[model samples]
Target: MDGCTGKIEQEMRAGLRAFFTVPYLLDQGMACLEEKLREALLFGRLTVLHYRAFGGTGAGIYRAAAAVEFMILSLDIIDDLQDKDNQETVWGRLSPDIALNIALGMLTLSQHLLLTADFPHERSGSAARLMNEQVLAAINGQTVDLLNNIESEEEYMEMIRLKSAGLLAAACLTGTLLATGEPLSEVRTYAEELGIAAQMKNDIRDVLNWDNKNDFWNRKKTLPTLYLLQSISDEQRWIADYFAERLQLADVVNRKEEIERIMEESGTLLYSSVRMRTHYYNYLDLVGKISLAPEWKEQILAMAD
Candidate 1:
């Protein structure tokens, strides 16, 4: 995987270069921002993973892979703006209005690249449509997540499937659609399950943090947070109070270690990890069911692990 990661970054760099020519983009340093996105090319890697798994062997898929990367980065910028997080990012460093414009530009560039690229398959339209569908679903998820209206772990899982897993599903599906002319349902299921599992892992990490990005500080009703709240003790009233808005994060931030210890004592983190692993194994099972070569299937499973 590491061997191919460099090649993907190189291809993505070439594809991302196309967006820098826009006058506004040039003026806004969006080119540098695009370069920054190259550091984390996970979405592009997923595209390549599916492409190769489905027997795609051309360089053209790199174009579409880069497009997926651009689309994901666009959403990430918008998410950061919505959540007011990762202030060190290019979008974060710039004003929200300017960042919004850059995000839109990236998104448009992704679609343009996808539509205009000379893919070997002629049904590129199907790929574009699927991308749009998944992105729209992600938007709905992001809206609900931002609103923080989740009531149960079931609801949280549903929301994350849309927000996190949807993008992964789209990335994999884009590759499959561009290569096979039809999106494979098994691939979609595996990608979605993997996405949810990955998001749960992230949620576990998020709850352990004590910063602006801390889920606890933000009052995010994640699986672990909900579990932690379910059985609170007298000393844990602050945790409840904080979630209830009776206490501000500033008052509780310094005591983060104490609360984290309490969360650990309550088995919140372990519960979250077990839940994540359960979804992960489900994804692995679905991957095994995909009708690919044994080696390719092994590679795909190994990549996820």
Candidate 2:
């Protein structure tokens, strides 16, 4: 890890140790924290990057990053539990009740860390409010996603805006609010664009996977899946039948290669790629409009990658 990310991870570990008093909870929290630390701390890095980009100088910014990471970790566990996927994750392997309790505790700890960070009272309040608002928006989005009733590209976009974009926006806005005591509208716009692009990329990958997480297997109405459904030939009607529940997984278990070929031939992948690229470029364009040094802009762009 880079120096900044290493510092953020250190702070995250400290926060877990300081707040989790019960031995069992501490062990579980630490296990989940280590699991998350194995990957890039993208959201936490966004918080720190924005803080630095906005001229924040306090050491408490690391604490703020920790808070962001803790909240994200909690939400990730909740998402996996809700989806009943990612069974290899530490939380997924634990008892559902234990995992749920760990998630709840970490969530509250995130708020505590944020509210208690060494910032001006007004800045802390503003940051907390922004964080809570975005978190609530994410929860609402996740609720809509769980219902699995999205039927249009517009609905899918809206759901992802709330579920995915909201978290990214919150991470950026937290740092901005802590530094400037005002939420930067430009930061929000670019962050949301980035979030949408990232989620679309994930959707494309999920649709291609031949596992429980496969969007087609789950009948998920992602943009790519919707496109596939709309563009399939009569010979590919079995795909539609499976989605509509007229056919079952048994009917298509051995057709993975055929389905992949269909996805490629139907222009579904290209369409999804083009749409994802549009949002990604929009994010870069919006970031360019922000009043920052060229190097800062470059750094932010690198972080997105």
Candidate 3:
């Protein structure tokens, strides 16, 4: 395994050691994510810093600001060490100083969140101090989404834009800061939008595949269903209507072929595809707008491409 992934695996192990040890999982969702992160680190081939960032933040939620900083450390180390063929490029020259700098910067932001912030959590000071920033970001993202969801086309785009993409954008922004000692807000916005669209495609697979279709069963107000509301033929419409009322996975699965055909023919996939491209271009455009170093810009473009 690569050094970055190795670190992720190690971090995950430590987190799980603490996780399963807890009598009742404090937050199952976060706990489950940590577990998944452990498995992904153990199994996958991710050299990216954000992967490690996701892996490393098992110290509860107060360390998002910290997570951002360490992500930069991981990115800088990866860039310095990995060469053209994705082999080690500059491990020998990569300084401990850089690593230390990354940690200190991350800790600095984490501490900043602690001192002064009206985060979401009313009871848990640490949680409010830590995750409140992310929660606020989420709320802001959701606010924009509520406005956009009025239109069918925009609702899908907006859902994908806010849910997963927001964090991805923040992560990349943090990564860039660690590498270049500078921030790029324009690129940040673009990355955020692209991340959302990519995540939507990910969510779509839940329905597309047989693993889970809870989104439909739950009437999740997701983009796919929203798109389907205005899309598909009467035949497709009736099936979704039935599912909306009945909400049984087997009911849908019994007629999966027919439902899938309707979705495909109704242009839901095509519409989603077009929106995804639009997000990517939006990111690319934002990247171009940034007054960043050419080398750094190249790196940003390369990462996205």
Candidate 4:
């Protein structure tokens, strides 16, 4: 997402600064998570940006034809177990173990006050269960996302809701746990809404999703395709079928140009963004309903900075 919702950004930053200021709780949880996952290979672990610890996840996918093809080509199940030199490597390098560890750490840290987590919920839990849920949610979400290509727009949104917002919901629940020790129902609602906003932010980054480098170039089903499917102009629908046939191609540049014209002429990108922002606004309004102190609620609101 290009910018945080100013309100959410303010609110979360304050809550985080306050919550982190407290001794040990956040750190202890994170330590456990790291120790758990570090033994496994972590993908996309570049240093330019630190993981947000929460929000819709974007990196865990084979987004290009080549990337998908690489997996298909590397089908020697024996290769992962027996290293070229050590035969007993016991690691896929991308083992679930590592993601588990990282996710666990995130859940633990999410619990602390972060600035008094009352307004929402999810304040109490056995640390282990919380972490376990985080990893499970991530994996489940990913599974549905992969299945989305074959689903309708409605199903696609559901996948995005799971894969992308599931953890974001966890983030709020964690915050609630640290703040008040309650069931996450209330907090989860807030999270579900915020999840929509977060996804909208992602759509902005995918400005190219409808462009020549469209995410659909890899056959990844996204919001635009669904909307198009729902209200496609004759010209765009004709072009979409053509795009589908080339989903696995090595080159999508030419197709992208054609789609770009269709997207522009049809106003798909703008329409998608408008819809996305509408979700964000709805999420923000949900946050506004929480019962926390004005300042605390405002702090949460400020986070969309």
Q: After superposition, how far is residue 153 of candidate 4 from its true place, in Å?
A: 2.6
lDDT of 4: 0.44
Residue 106 lDDT in model 3? 31
- For model 1, residues 1-305, the per-residue Cα lDDT tens digits are 44566665565565546666766666564554555555757778788878877777767777788788878888988999999978877668788897888888778878887887777446667888888988899999999999887878889988988889989989989888877888988888998999989999989999887667889889999999989998678978889889999998778878877887898899999999999999999998998887889988887777676
- 1-305, model 2: which lDDT tens digit per residue? 24877888888888888878899989998999999999989998889889888988868988898899989999999999999978999999999999999999888888888899989989988888888887899999999889887788999999999989889989999988888888999999999999999999999999998778999888888999999999999988988899889999988888889889999999999999999999999999999999999988998899777
Q: State the displacement of the C-alpha of residue 61, model 4, in Å, after optimal TM-score superposition.
A: 31
Best candidate according to lDDT: 2
With candidate 2 superimposed using the best TM-score fit, by how many Å does residue 275's alpha carbon deviate from the native? 0.4
Score candidate 4 by TM-score against the native.
Answer: 0.56
TM-score, cand. 3: 0.56
- State candidate 2's TM-score: 0.97
Q: Please give, for residues 98-207, the per-residue lDDT of candidate 3 as tens digits.
A: 43343343334333433332233431243323233543554465555444334555655554454456546655544334333333566457677667656666657645
Of models 3 and 4, which has the larger lDDT?
3
* Overall local distance difference test of candidate 3: 0.47
* Model 4, span 1-305: residue lDDT tens: 23222223233234334434534534532343233233311111110011122222332111111111111112112222222222222223434344233333333333332212222222233322453465466556666654545447577667667655655565445434433444347667766666766775665456465544345554456677555555667655554664467334545446667666666667777888887778778768876776655655565555544
- Alpha-carbon local distance difference test for all models: 0.81, 0.90, 0.47, 0.44
**Count of backbone collisions in candidate 2:** 0
Model 2 misplaced stretches (Cα beyond 4 Å): none
List the lowest-lDDT window of 10 residues for candidate 3.
Answer: 42-51
In TM-score terms, which candidate is top? 2
